[model samples]
Target: MLTDPTMWRPAGEMHRCLTDGGSAFTEIFGTPFFDHFARDAETAAVFHDGMAAMSEPENEPIAEAYDFPPTGTVVDVGGGHGGLLVEVLRRRPGLHGSSATRRTS
Candidate 1:
């Protein structure tokens, strides 16, 4: 649903004219993405879990592609499960920092 073009479809008087962002989706769904997500707990959990799962496959190549400072601090903002952070720090060594978005129950 995220790249749904119809969500941003233009309407009358909006023929290539810009308007407030809400005007885009409001005409169709009456609510925006964030609002919808917040209102639905199951959907929110799915989105969060999906995002966390996506990080694992990218960790190896990402670590291989970049050469982090041999010794310093590194932080992944939403470093889900610490997969990428662990790979990077393992490769670089001696780096220290904290992930602000650590998951906790």
Candidate 2:
């Protein structure tokens, strides 16, 4: 299993193999997973849809509990695609919206 990276290894065996090696499955898969999903349009869309559905309603309670000033520009830093910001704007229409992400070279 360790020698062959792509072979169909069972989950239990894979878990044991990685755990015994002191390397997490995430350690092996994280970079490639993010690289592929982040760059691929279809993958990114699927991921966003999943995340959006998860964010809604589950976040509403927390959103309702918080208080924001009636008017001001709220800059959401490193806000990925602005899902949370959209929710906040939807709840509080008076607040101005601004999102900033680190520019990728």
Q: Pick the candidate with the highest TM-score.
A: 1
In model 1, which regions exceed 4 Å deviation? 1-19, 22-42, 102-105
Output the lDDT of residue 71, model 1: 85
lDDT of 2 by residue, 1-105 (tens): 222332232333566665676424345545443454555557555655665676665556765677977788778775656777777787899998899944432
Q: Which 10 consecutive residues of model 2 have the lowest summed lDDT? A: 1-10
Residue-level lDDT of model 1, residues 1-105, one tens digit each, is: 223343335344364337444455455556654465567657656656666676778888999899788788898886646788888877876888667663333
Alpha-carbon deviation at 78 in model 1, angstroms:
2.4
C-alpha root-mean-square deviation, each candidate: 5.9, 6.9
Q: What lDDT does the true structure give each of the candidates?
A: 0.64, 0.60
C-alpha positional error of residue 99 in candidate 2 after TM-score superposition, expressed in Å: 2.9
